[model samples]
Target: MLKVQEIRELIKLIDQSSIDEFTYESDGTTVSMKKSNTAPQVVREAVINTPVQTTDTKLVKPEPVIEARKEVDMEKENQKTEQENTSISSYDHEIVSPMVGTFYSSPTPESDPFVSIGSNVQKDTIVCIVEAMKLFNEIEAEVSGEIVEILVDNGELVEYGQPLFRVKTK
Candidate 1:
């Protein structure tokens, strides 16, 4: 029988390597592991063939332990995302990029930015420009508010629907 520490080490080695399957049997104990192609995780099975005086025997599987750990990790990640979202006040609105492009704070490098943090704006006010396929598209504030935060920097690549700025709605 392999100790808990040995089994953990073997799992780490198998996860880091290209091996798809592995099996080990000794002293009536057998451990088998197979990697899932679709997901980067391993499926493991353990069987102990201990000789007992009773005729009844059953195979025990330890896969549930691994699955429970995965569930816990997912829950932690969800909590983290929730915390980030809650950091912004409910009265705040986010200005998002309409298309994939390079974000520009100003029309030209030498010109002043259209909007900045603490700057008040109206719904139709042009806050910035997003250049996609060589076409410069002026982005509006969308909501009347004071700029609370600028999420993206000048000349940075912005994705469609990605938040570019946070505004405190008036």
Candidate 2:
């Protein structure tokens, strides 16, 4: 469980820092924070090339200086995201365990496993359970995919970022 004061301090840092994202891991807990982007003021300018007429003739030309402004393309960003998703599905992707703990196949003993090979899953689906410091933490899927393989057995010790399962992204 997170202490109230610690949580409050985290919120204060978020309010103070210019960073839009932060991630921290300690004592079997992982916390990720993100903030949205703000629009920037755009300025544009022009450029002119000056040529020397002759070596003997010194000519003074007023050149038009244009400031170049970068435009953000939404379509390109979307296409990149689509390409990333396509690549992720081409091979089995690792479902990383977030903490060091005793991994459980189910929330409790004598229950059917939370997931198995070839299980289809959404982002929020609980793939396994990890017990740390007597606290049960549900390990969730970050990607929507089908389980391709199980890397760890039930009751196995799992380290952070260890491959708990290999998934085939949809």
Candidate 3:
């Protein structure tokens, strides 16, 4: 069995190296680690030999041995499909502004915006401000959910089909 430090070292090694597979075996114990950038990406895996308990020692414990980490060729196709699905779904479901303008994350020059990352909002909640022809337009949320990610920066100029906020489904 490898020590915790050795395992951590192995992880660092794997990260630094471009090689995908590594296996080490000694005596009756066999351990293996692998990395592959295959479709649906199976990135890393580490295996360790389990140790039996002894009455004389309580210092070391065995780690959960990783068996295998390999990319499934079949899932590669599914990954592309999923990407397409997400793109289409995201396109069909966005909070479009009624007019073109400079987008703002806050309600006023000094006031903080109505929403931020991980903020829970309703369908009609105002999320941002759009200044069109010197008029501030409150852009409301069309979907009710938690803000997953912010796509736009503060005081960014927004155009049609430009995403400003990404929301997680309720």
Candidate 4:
């Protein structure tokens, strides 16, 4: 495994090199580096006979810089989410799982479903519940529409990005 100083030196080298990223792996040791506007961030991991150990650290670290980096990371995440929403908008409209979990059509076993085919719905309408990791999350219809189809069944396992209902836009 590379020492901390060695990794730091590599970051400096990469920052000076023409490459934008660098990676190395051998004998259960792995190192990855990527250049950003601020500085290069390096992630190191060891997966030897023992359990895996991982660490991600900045060579030129500062408290305010870390906070700024987090904000930038969050902005990237928000942009990615916006792109995904754009893709979903291409559909007539879809009520989808926000996470991987079991789909529940109703609040209780004997209760009627929140929405059915032909049911008119609007943004903020609770279309269903997704039980993820012991948490029952109310899934909402973010767009106004009429439910054209139910894509998933109650108590069925649903994956992230899976469409639970198809809607005809209002």
- Quote the positional error of residue 25 for candidate 2 in Å: 47
What are the per-residue Cα lDDT tens digits for candidate 2 across 21-57? 7666555444555554532212222333465466778
lDDT of 3 by residue, 103-169 (tens): 8888777997789876888989999988888999888888888776677777778887677777766
TM-score of every candidate relative to the true structure: 0.52, 0.47, 0.45, 0.47
Off by over 4 Å in 1: 1-86
The better candidate by TM-score, 3 or 4, is 4
Specify the highest-TM-score model's number.
1
Q: After superposition, how far is residue 47 of candidate 4 from its true place, in Å?
A: 38
Model 4 Cα lDDT, one tens digit per residue, 73-155: 43576799997677566448777789999999999999999999888898999999999999999999999988877889889
Against the true structure, candidate 1 reaches a TM-score of 0.52
Q: State each model's C-alpha RMSD to the native.
A: 16.0, 19.4, 13.7, 13.7
Clashing pairs in 1: none
Model 3 C-alpha lDDT versus the unseen true structure: 0.69
Candidate 1 lDDT tens digits, 65-121: 222112124357679889678757643789999999999999999999999989999
Model 3 clash count equals: 0
Candidate 3's displacement at residue 9, Å, is 43
Q: After superposition, how far is residue 87 of candidate 4 from its true place, in Å?
A: 17
What is the lDDT of every predicted structure here?
0.78, 0.72, 0.69, 0.78
Q: What TM-score number comes out for model 2?
A: 0.47
